[model samples]
Target: MIEDPQGTVLALFAAFCRVGGCFMLLPGFSSARLPMQIRLFLAVAISMAILPLLWDTIYPRAADPVASYVRLIVFETLTGAVIGLIARYFVLGLQFAGTVLTMMIGFNAPPSPDVIEDTAENQLTNLISFAALMVLFLLDFHHVILRALVESYTTMPLGAGFNPQGALITLADTLKQTFDIMLRLASPFIVYGLLFNIAVGLVNKLAPQIPIYFISLPFLICGGLFLVYFGISSMLEIFAAAFIPVFEGR
Candidate 1:
Protein backbone atom coordinates (compact mmCIF):
# COMPACT_ATOMS: atom_id res chain seq x y z
CA MET A 1 0.00 0.00 0.00
CA ILE A 2 3.03 2.27 -0.04
CA GLU A 3 2.91 5.07 -2.61
CA ASP A 4 6.19 6.27 -4.12
CA PRO A 5 8.17 3.33 -2.80
CA GLN A 6 11.19 4.36 -4.86
CA GLY A 7 11.30 7.71 -3.11
CA THR A 8 11.19 6.07 0.28
CA VAL A 9 14.00 3.71 -0.63
CA LEU A 10 16.14 6.55 -1.96
CA ALA A 11 15.51 8.58 1.17
CA LEU A 12 16.53 5.62 3.32
CA PHE A 13 19.69 5.21 1.27
CA ALA A 14 20.49 8.89 1.70
CA ALA A 15 20.08 8.59 5.45
CA PHE A 16 22.36 5.56 5.41
CA CYS A 17 24.99 7.53 3.51
CA ARG A 18 25.18 10.08 6.29
CA VAL A 19 24.90 7.81 9.31
CA GLY A 20 27.14 5.11 7.91
CA GLY A 21 29.75 7.66 6.92
CA CYS A 22 29.85 8.91 10.47
CA PHE A 23 30.19 5.44 11.93
CA MET A 24 33.02 4.69 9.52
CA LEU A 25 35.20 7.21 11.33
CA LEU A 26 33.67 7.41 14.78
CA PRO A 27 36.16 6.63 17.56
CA GLY A 28 34.95 3.66 19.61
CA PHE A 29 32.48 2.26 17.12
CA SER A 30 34.99 2.51 14.32
CA SER A 31 37.79 0.75 16.20
CA ALA A 32 39.64 -1.99 14.39
CA ARG A 33 38.45 -4.47 16.99
CA LEU A 34 34.91 -4.07 15.63
CA PRO A 35 33.94 -6.05 12.53
CA MET A 36 32.92 -4.11 9.44
CA GLN A 37 29.65 -6.01 9.09
CA ILE A 38 28.61 -5.12 12.63
CA ARG A 39 29.37 -1.48 12.07
CA LEU A 40 27.40 -1.49 8.82
CA PHE A 41 24.40 -3.09 10.47
CA LEU A 42 24.53 -0.64 13.36
CA ALA A 43 24.64 2.27 10.97
CA VAL A 44 21.68 0.89 9.03
CA ALA A 45 19.68 0.43 12.23
CA ILE A 46 20.43 3.94 13.41
CA SER A 47 19.53 5.40 10.03
CA MET A 48 16.19 3.60 10.05
CA ALA A 49 15.37 4.71 13.56
CA ILE A 50 15.97 8.37 12.70
CA LEU A 51 14.48 8.30 9.21
CA PRO A 52 11.00 9.03 10.43
CA LEU A 53 12.09 12.26 12.04
CA LEU A 54 14.03 13.28 8.93
CA TRP A 55 11.49 12.09 6.31
CA ASP A 56 10.01 15.45 5.42
CA THR A 57 13.43 16.98 4.87
CA ILE A 58 15.00 13.99 3.11
CA TYR A 59 12.17 12.42 1.09
CA PRO A 60 11.49 15.47 -1.05
CA ARG A 61 15.14 15.77 -1.86
CA ALA A 62 15.27 12.08 -2.65
CA ALA A 63 12.39 12.38 -5.10
CA ASP A 64 14.59 14.58 -7.27
CA PRO A 65 16.30 13.23 -10.42
CA VAL A 66 18.84 10.44 -10.17
CA ALA A 67 21.74 12.82 -10.70
CA SER A 68 20.52 14.98 -7.84
CA TYR A 69 20.34 11.94 -5.61
CA VAL A 70 23.94 11.03 -6.42
CA ARG A 71 25.07 14.55 -5.52
CA LEU A 72 23.17 14.38 -2.24
CA ILE A 73 24.81 11.06 -1.40
CA VAL A 74 28.23 12.59 -1.83
CA PHE A 75 27.44 15.76 0.08
CA GLU A 76 25.75 13.96 2.96
CA THR A 77 28.62 11.50 3.29
CA LEU A 78 31.16 14.29 3.45
CA THR A 79 29.09 16.17 6.01
CA GLY A 80 28.81 13.16 8.26
CA ALA A 81 32.52 12.38 7.91
CA VAL A 82 33.35 15.92 8.94
CA ILE A 83 31.11 15.64 11.98
CA GLY A 84 32.59 12.26 12.93
CA LEU A 85 36.16 13.48 12.54
CA ILE A 86 35.46 16.32 14.94
CA ALA A 87 34.80 13.79 17.67
CA ARG A 88 37.55 11.45 16.48
CA TYR A 89 40.11 14.23 16.72
CA PHE A 90 39.26 14.84 20.36
CA VAL A 91 39.70 11.17 21.22
CA LEU A 92 42.93 11.08 19.27
CA GLY A 93 44.21 13.89 21.42
CA LEU A 94 44.27 11.48 24.34
CA GLN A 95 46.58 9.20 22.39
CA PHE A 96 48.77 12.16 21.56
CA ALA A 97 48.97 13.06 25.22
CA GLY A 98 49.80 9.47 26.12
CA THR A 99 52.65 9.39 23.62
CA VAL A 100 54.03 12.61 25.03
CA LEU A 101 53.63 11.27 28.54
CA THR A 102 55.51 8.08 27.70
CA MET A 103 58.41 9.99 26.16
CA MET A 104 58.63 12.45 29.02
CA ILE A 105 58.55 9.66 31.60
CA GLY A 106 61.20 7.62 29.79
CA PHE A 107 58.99 4.55 29.42
CA ASN A 108 59.91 3.08 26.07
CA ALA A 109 57.99 -0.13 25.90
CA PRO A 110 57.92 -1.93 22.56
CA PRO A 111 55.14 -0.99 20.19
CA SER A 112 52.13 -3.28 20.05
CA PRO A 113 48.90 -3.41 18.13
CA ASP A 114 46.45 -0.78 19.30
CA VAL A 115 42.92 -1.80 20.16
CA ILE A 116 41.47 1.26 18.46
CA GLU A 117 43.55 1.53 15.32
CA ASP A 118 45.47 -0.95 13.22
CA THR A 119 48.74 0.86 13.84
CA ALA A 120 51.19 -0.24 16.48
CA GLU A 121 51.52 2.03 19.52
CA ASN A 122 53.48 2.18 22.74
CA GLN A 123 51.90 0.12 25.49
CA LEU A 124 51.25 3.10 27.73
CA THR A 125 49.76 4.99 24.85
CA ASN A 126 47.51 2.05 24.08
CA LEU A 127 46.44 1.74 27.69
CA ILE A 128 45.58 5.41 28.09
CA SER A 129 43.72 5.65 24.80
CA PHE A 130 41.71 2.52 25.60
CA ALA A 131 40.83 3.75 29.08
CA ALA A 132 39.73 7.16 27.92
CA LEU A 133 37.62 5.70 25.12
CA MET A 134 36.02 3.26 27.54
CA VAL A 135 35.17 6.11 29.88
CA LEU A 136 33.51 8.03 27.07
CA PHE A 137 31.47 4.98 26.14
CA LEU A 138 30.39 4.57 29.76
CA LEU A 139 29.25 8.19 29.64
CA ASP A 140 27.05 7.43 26.60
CA PHE A 141 28.96 9.64 24.19
CA HIS A 142 27.12 7.96 21.28
CA HIS A 143 23.86 9.47 22.46
CA VAL A 144 25.38 12.93 22.32
CA ILE A 145 26.70 12.26 18.83
CA LEU A 146 23.29 11.09 17.61
CA ARG A 147 21.57 14.14 19.03
CA ALA A 148 24.07 16.40 17.37
CA LEU A 149 23.61 14.61 14.07
CA VAL A 150 19.85 15.12 14.26
CA GLU A 151 20.31 18.79 15.08
CA SER A 152 22.80 19.20 12.23
CA TYR A 153 19.89 19.15 9.75
CA THR A 154 19.05 22.69 10.83
CA THR A 155 22.55 24.01 10.22
CA MET A 156 23.41 21.79 7.26
CA PRO A 157 20.15 20.86 5.57
CA LEU A 158 19.81 18.19 2.89
CA GLY A 159 21.16 19.04 -0.56
CA ALA A 160 23.20 21.97 0.68
CA GLY A 161 26.26 22.47 -1.45
CA PHE A 162 29.46 21.20 0.10
CA ASN A 163 31.83 23.84 1.49
CA PRO A 164 35.32 22.44 1.57
CA GLN A 165 36.79 25.67 2.89
CA GLY A 166 34.40 25.72 5.83
CA ALA A 167 35.16 22.09 6.59
CA LEU A 168 38.89 22.75 6.48
CA ILE A 169 38.57 25.69 8.82
CA THR A 170 36.53 23.62 11.25
CA LEU A 171 39.12 20.84 11.10
CA ALA A 172 41.97 23.25 11.67
CA ASP A 173 40.22 24.80 14.66
CA THR A 174 39.51 21.38 16.13
CA LEU A 175 43.14 20.37 15.76
CA LYS A 176 44.31 23.50 17.51
CA GLN A 177 41.88 23.07 20.39
CA THR A 178 42.60 19.35 20.83
CA PHE A 179 46.35 19.94 20.70
CA ASP A 180 46.09 22.70 23.29
CA ILE A 181 44.22 20.40 25.66
CA MET A 182 46.75 17.63 25.15
CA LEU A 183 49.64 19.96 25.89
CA ARG A 184 48.00 21.14 29.07
CA LEU A 185 47.39 17.57 30.22
CA ALA A 186 50.97 16.57 29.49
CA SER A 187 52.68 19.75 30.69
CA PRO A 188 53.46 18.49 34.16
CA PHE A 189 55.31 15.45 32.85
CA ILE A 190 57.15 17.61 30.34
CA VAL A 191 58.37 19.88 33.08
CA TYR A 192 59.27 16.97 35.26
CA GLY A 193 61.28 15.34 32.51
CA LEU A 194 63.14 18.55 31.75
CA LEU A 195 64.08 19.30 35.32
CA PHE A 196 64.92 15.69 36.11
CA ASN A 197 67.17 15.37 33.08
CA ILE A 198 68.96 18.61 33.93
CA ALA A 199 69.65 17.43 37.47
CA VAL A 200 70.83 14.08 36.19
CA GLY A 201 73.14 15.86 33.73
CA LEU A 202 74.67 17.94 36.53
CA VAL A 203 75.23 14.89 38.66
CA ASN A 204 76.91 13.10 35.77
CA LYS A 205 79.16 16.10 35.09
CA LEU A 206 80.19 16.38 38.74
CA ALA A 207 81.14 12.69 38.85
CA PRO A 208 82.17 11.58 35.40
CA GLN A 209 83.31 8.15 36.68
CA ILE A 210 79.90 7.37 38.21
CA PRO A 211 77.10 6.13 35.93
CA ILE A 212 74.65 8.69 37.30
CA TYR A 213 72.43 8.59 34.21
CA PHE A 214 71.90 4.87 34.49
CA ILE A 215 71.42 5.13 38.26
CA SER A 216 68.76 7.82 37.92
CA LEU A 217 66.78 6.05 35.18
CA PRO A 218 64.87 3.88 37.63
CA PHE A 219 64.05 6.83 39.85
CA LEU A 220 62.85 8.88 36.90
CA ILE A 221 60.62 6.05 35.69
CA CYS A 222 59.21 5.48 39.17
CA GLY A 223 58.48 9.13 39.73
CA GLY A 224 56.73 9.41 36.40
CA LEU A 225 54.60 6.37 37.11
CA PHE A 226 53.61 7.86 40.45
CA LEU A 227 52.57 11.08 38.79
CA VAL A 228 50.48 9.21 36.25
CA TYR A 229 48.81 7.12 38.94
CA PHE A 230 47.54 10.22 40.65
CA GLY A 231 46.76 12.30 37.57
CA ILE A 232 45.22 9.79 35.17
CA SER A 233 41.76 9.76 36.72
CA SER A 234 41.53 13.54 36.58
CA MET A 235 42.96 13.64 33.08
CA LEU A 236 40.35 11.25 31.68
CA GLU A 237 37.62 13.08 33.61
CA ILE A 238 38.51 16.32 31.86
CA PHE A 239 38.73 14.54 28.50
CA ALA A 240 35.29 12.94 28.85
CA ALA A 241 33.79 16.27 29.90
CA ALA A 242 35.24 18.03 26.87
CA PHE A 243 33.93 15.60 24.23
CA ILE A 244 30.37 16.92 23.87
CA PRO A 245 31.39 20.57 24.04
CA VAL A 246 34.17 20.13 21.50
CA PHE A 247 32.11 18.03 19.09
CA GLU A 248 29.10 20.35 19.29
CA GLY A 249 31.35 23.35 18.61
CA ARG A 250 30.29 24.96 21.87
Candidate 2:
Protein backbone atom coordinates (compact mmCIF):
# COMPACT_ATOMS: atom_id res chain seq x y z
CA MET A 1 0.00 0.00 0.00
CA ILE A 2 1.01 3.65 -0.43
CA GLU A 3 2.68 5.01 2.70
CA ASP A 4 2.28 8.73 1.92
CA PRO A 5 -0.49 9.71 -0.43
CA GLN A 6 -0.08 13.41 0.15
CA GLY A 7 3.64 13.40 -0.60
CA THR A 8 3.03 11.35 -3.73
CA VAL A 9 0.41 13.76 -4.99
CA LEU A 10 2.59 16.74 -4.36
CA ALA A 11 5.49 15.08 -6.12
CA LEU A 12 3.27 14.28 -9.08
CA PHE A 13 2.09 17.85 -9.27
CA ALA A 14 5.65 19.12 -9.22
CA ALA A 15 6.57 16.80 -12.05
CA PHE A 16 3.51 17.92 -13.96
CA CYS A 17 4.38 21.55 -13.52
CA ARG A 18 7.59 21.01 -15.42
CA VAL A 19 6.44 18.42 -17.92
CA GLY A 20 3.17 20.22 -18.61
CA GLY A 21 4.94 23.51 -18.97
CA CYS A 22 7.23 21.98 -21.57
CA PHE A 23 4.33 20.45 -23.50
CA MET A 24 2.51 23.75 -23.41
CA LEU A 25 5.15 25.17 -25.75
CA LEU A 26 6.40 22.06 -27.49
CA PRO A 27 6.09 22.23 -31.29
CA GLY A 28 3.72 19.54 -32.56
CA PHE A 29 2.12 18.91 -29.15
CA SER A 30 1.40 22.60 -28.58
CA SER A 31 -0.38 23.16 -31.91
CA ALA A 32 -3.51 25.25 -31.74
CA ARG A 33 -5.26 22.40 -33.51
CA LEU A 34 -4.72 20.12 -30.52
CA PRO A 35 -7.40 20.21 -27.83
CA MET A 36 -6.17 21.60 -24.53
CA GLN A 37 -7.61 18.64 -22.63
CA ILE A 38 -5.67 16.21 -24.72
CA ARG A 39 -2.47 18.12 -24.12
CA LEU A 40 -3.13 18.24 -20.39
CA PHE A 41 -3.82 14.51 -20.22
CA LEU A 42 -0.72 13.70 -22.19
CA ALA A 43 1.37 15.82 -19.87
CA VAL A 44 -0.16 14.12 -16.88
CA ALA A 45 0.48 10.68 -18.33
CA ILE A 46 4.10 11.47 -19.09
CA SER A 47 4.60 12.93 -15.64
CA MET A 48 3.19 9.84 -14.00
CA ALA A 49 5.42 7.62 -16.08
CA ILE A 50 8.55 9.61 -15.25
CA LEU A 51 7.82 10.40 -11.63
CA PRO A 52 9.25 7.19 -10.22
CA LEU A 53 12.59 7.98 -11.78
CA LEU A 54 12.61 11.42 -10.17
CA TRP A 55 11.05 10.39 -6.83
CA ASP A 56 14.10 10.99 -4.68
CA THR A 57 14.81 14.38 -6.14
CA ILE A 58 11.20 15.59 -6.31
CA TYR A 59 9.46 13.90 -3.37
CA PRO A 60 11.79 15.39 -0.78
CA ARG A 61 11.31 18.84 -2.21
CA ALA A 62 7.53 18.40 -2.19
CA ALA A 63 7.54 18.32 1.61
CA ASP A 64 8.17 22.07 1.83
CA PRO A 65 5.61 24.52 3.18
CA VAL A 66 2.82 25.71 0.90
CA ALA A 67 4.49 28.99 0.00
CA SER A 68 7.78 27.27 -0.76
CA TYR A 69 5.93 24.66 -2.80
CA VAL A 70 4.29 27.38 -4.84
CA ARG A 71 7.65 28.98 -5.48
CA LEU A 72 9.06 25.63 -6.52
CA ILE A 73 6.13 25.17 -8.89
CA VAL A 74 6.89 28.45 -10.56
CA PHE A 75 10.57 27.67 -10.83
CA GLU A 76 9.93 24.20 -12.26
CA THR A 77 7.50 25.61 -14.80
CA LEU A 78 10.01 28.22 -15.90
CA THR A 79 12.75 25.62 -16.27
CA GLY A 80 10.54 23.45 -18.43
CA ALA A 81 9.51 26.43 -20.51
CA VAL A 82 13.12 27.38 -21.12
CA ILE A 83 13.94 23.87 -22.25
CA GLY A 84 10.85 23.67 -24.46
CA LEU A 85 11.51 27.08 -26.01
CA ILE A 86 14.98 25.95 -26.99
CA ALA A 87 13.34 23.36 -29.22
CA ARG A 88 10.54 25.70 -30.27
CA TYR A 89 12.89 28.41 -31.49
CA PHE A 90 14.36 26.03 -34.03
CA VAL A 91 10.92 25.24 -35.45
CA LEU A 92 10.18 28.94 -35.59
CA GLY A 93 13.41 29.38 -37.48
CA LEU A 94 12.22 26.86 -40.03
CA GLN A 95 8.94 28.72 -40.38
CA PHE A 96 10.81 31.98 -40.83
CA ALA A 97 12.95 30.38 -43.50
CA GLY A 98 9.84 29.13 -45.26
CA THR A 99 8.37 32.63 -45.21
CA VAL A 100 11.55 34.04 -46.69
CA LEU A 101 11.57 31.32 -49.32
CA THR A 102 7.97 32.10 -50.28
CA MET A 103 8.65 35.80 -50.81
CA MET A 104 11.91 35.19 -52.60
CA ILE A 105 10.23 32.80 -55.01
CA GLY A 106 7.56 35.42 -55.70
CA PHE A 107 4.58 33.40 -54.53
CA ASN A 108 2.17 35.96 -53.04
CA ALA A 109 -0.78 33.65 -52.80
CA PRO A 110 -3.36 34.78 -50.25
CA PRO A 111 -2.74 33.70 -46.69
CA SER A 112 -4.46 30.59 -45.42
CA PRO A 113 -4.96 29.19 -41.92
CA ASP A 114 -1.77 27.76 -40.42
CA VAL A 115 -1.65 24.12 -39.46
CA ILE A 116 -0.15 24.85 -36.02
CA GLU A 117 -0.79 28.48 -35.14
CA ASP A 118 -4.09 30.38 -35.35
CA THR A 119 -2.52 32.95 -37.63
CA ALA A 120 -2.72 32.89 -41.42
CA GLU A 121 0.35 32.07 -43.47
CA ASN A 122 1.28 31.75 -47.11
CA GLN A 123 0.33 28.41 -48.65
CA LEU A 124 3.91 27.47 -49.51
CA THR A 125 5.15 28.42 -46.06
CA ASN A 126 2.41 26.36 -44.48
CA LEU A 127 3.21 23.44 -46.70
CA ILE A 128 6.93 23.56 -45.93
CA SER A 129 6.44 24.00 -42.19
CA PHE A 130 3.94 21.15 -42.04
CA ALA A 131 6.17 18.88 -44.05
CA ALA A 132 9.22 19.66 -41.95
CA LEU A 133 7.34 19.08 -38.69
CA MET A 134 5.93 15.82 -40.03
CA VAL A 135 9.38 14.63 -40.95
CA LEU A 136 10.65 15.45 -37.46
CA PHE A 137 7.78 13.49 -35.98
CA LEU A 138 8.57 10.52 -38.20
CA LEU A 139 12.14 10.67 -36.94
CA ASP A 140 10.96 10.55 -33.31
CA PHE A 141 12.02 14.05 -32.35
CA HIS A 142 9.65 14.05 -29.35
CA HIS A 143 11.39 11.01 -27.93
CA VAL A 144 14.66 12.88 -28.01
CA ILE A 145 13.07 15.83 -26.24
CA LEU A 146 11.59 13.65 -23.51
CA ARG A 147 14.93 12.04 -22.91
CA ALA A 148 16.49 15.47 -22.54
CA LEU A 149 13.80 16.48 -20.11
CA VAL A 150 14.61 13.48 -17.95
CA GLU A 151 18.25 14.43 -17.95
CA SER A 152 17.45 18.04 -17.10
CA TYR A 153 17.13 17.33 -13.37
CA THR A 154 20.88 17.06 -13.20
CA THR A 155 21.35 20.43 -14.87
CA MET A 156 18.40 22.17 -13.18
CA PRO A 157 17.70 20.44 -9.90
CA LEU A 158 14.51 21.05 -7.99
CA GLY A 159 14.62 23.91 -5.40
CA ALA A 160 17.11 25.95 -7.37
CA GLY A 161 15.05 29.02 -8.08
CA PHE A 162 14.47 30.16 -11.66
CA ASN A 163 17.43 31.82 -13.35
CA PRO A 164 16.04 34.54 -15.54
CA GLN A 165 19.43 35.82 -16.64
CA GLY A 166 20.67 32.39 -17.61
CA ALA A 167 17.38 31.57 -19.31
CA LEU A 168 17.47 34.77 -21.35
CA ILE A 169 21.05 34.14 -22.39
CA THR A 170 20.24 30.62 -23.45
CA LEU A 171 17.19 31.78 -25.39
CA ALA A 172 19.19 34.57 -27.05
CA ASP A 173 21.91 32.14 -28.11
CA THR A 174 19.41 29.67 -29.48
CA LEU A 175 17.74 32.40 -31.51
CA LYS A 176 21.03 33.62 -32.91
CA GLN A 177 22.07 30.14 -33.97
CA THR A 178 18.64 29.33 -35.36
CA PHE A 179 18.49 32.55 -37.35
CA ASP A 180 21.94 31.91 -38.78
CA ILE A 181 20.86 28.44 -39.91
CA MET A 182 17.64 29.79 -41.41
CA LEU A 183 19.50 32.39 -43.41
CA ARG A 184 21.88 29.79 -44.75
CA LEU A 185 18.99 27.51 -45.73
CA ALA A 186 17.22 30.40 -47.48
CA SER A 187 20.29 31.93 -49.14
CA PRO A 188 19.86 30.11 -52.45
CA PHE A 189 16.38 31.49 -52.93
CA ILE A 190 17.62 34.92 -51.95
CA VAL A 191 20.20 34.82 -54.71
CA TYR A 192 17.73 33.42 -57.22
CA GLY A 193 15.21 36.15 -56.42
CA LEU A 194 17.80 38.89 -56.62
CA LEU A 195 19.29 37.78 -59.95
CA PHE A 196 15.94 36.95 -61.50
CA ASN A 197 14.43 40.32 -60.56
CA ILE A 198 17.52 42.18 -61.81
CA ALA A 199 17.32 40.46 -65.19
CA VAL A 200 13.62 41.24 -65.40
CA GLY A 201 14.28 44.88 -64.52
CA LEU A 202 16.91 45.14 -67.30
CA VAL A 203 14.46 43.67 -69.78
CA ASN A 204 11.78 46.14 -68.67
CA LYS A 205 14.22 49.02 -69.19
CA LEU A 206 15.05 47.86 -72.71
CA ALA A 207 11.42 47.40 -73.79
CA PRO A 208 9.21 49.82 -71.88
CA GLN A 209 6.07 48.80 -73.79
CA ILE A 210 6.58 45.03 -73.42
CA PRO A 211 5.09 44.72 -69.91
CA ILE A 212 7.98 42.48 -68.93
CA TYR A 213 7.00 42.38 -65.26
CA PHE A 214 3.61 40.91 -66.11
CA ILE A 215 5.21 38.57 -68.63
CA SER A 216 7.82 37.40 -66.13
CA LEU A 217 5.41 36.55 -63.32
CA PRO A 218 4.50 33.13 -64.63
CA PHE A 219 8.13 32.25 -65.29
CA LEU A 220 9.15 33.38 -61.83
CA ILE A 221 6.46 31.31 -60.21
CA CYS A 222 7.23 28.27 -62.32
CA GLY A 223 10.96 28.51 -61.71
CA GLY A 224 10.39 28.86 -58.00
CA LEU A 225 8.17 25.78 -57.94
CA PHE A 226 10.78 23.81 -59.84
CA LEU A 227 13.47 24.89 -57.42
CA VAL A 228 11.34 23.80 -54.49
CA TYR A 229 10.62 20.43 -56.07
CA PHE A 230 14.29 19.71 -56.61
CA GLY A 231 15.61 21.30 -53.43
CA ILE A 232 13.01 20.34 -50.83
CA SER A 233 14.49 16.93 -50.07
CA SER A 234 17.90 18.42 -49.31
CA MET A 235 16.40 21.30 -47.38
CA LEU A 236 14.35 19.11 -45.07
CA GLU A 237 17.24 16.71 -44.65
CA ILE A 238 19.45 19.47 -43.33
CA PHE A 239 16.69 20.75 -41.06
CA ALA A 240 15.93 17.37 -39.51
CA ALA A 241 19.59 16.63 -38.98
CA ALA A 242 20.14 19.93 -37.22
CA PHE A 243 17.12 19.62 -34.92
CA ILE A 244 18.49 17.06 -32.43
CA PRO A 245 21.88 18.64 -31.91
CA VAL A 246 20.41 22.09 -31.42
CA PHE A 247 17.63 20.83 -29.16
CA GLU A 248 19.93 18.80 -26.93
CA GLY A 249 22.18 21.83 -26.48
CA ARG A 250 25.07 20.24 -28.34
TM-score, one value per model? 0.97, 0.97
C-alpha root-mean-square deviation, each candidate: 1.2, 1.2
**Model 2, 1-250: lDDT tens per residue?**
8899988999999999999889999999999999999999999999999999989998988866654887888999999998889989999999999999999889999999998899999999999999999999999999998998899888888887888999999999899889988898899899999999999999989888998978998899899999999999999999999888787773
lDDT (Cα, 0-100) at 207 in candidate 2? 88
Model 1 per-residue lDDT tens digits across residues 70-124:
7888999999998899989998888989999999999988899987889999998
Model 2 regions lying over 4 Å from their true place = none
Query: Which 10-residue window of candidate 1 scores lowest in summed lDDT?
Result: 61-70
lDDT scores of the candidates, listed in order = 0.89, 0.91
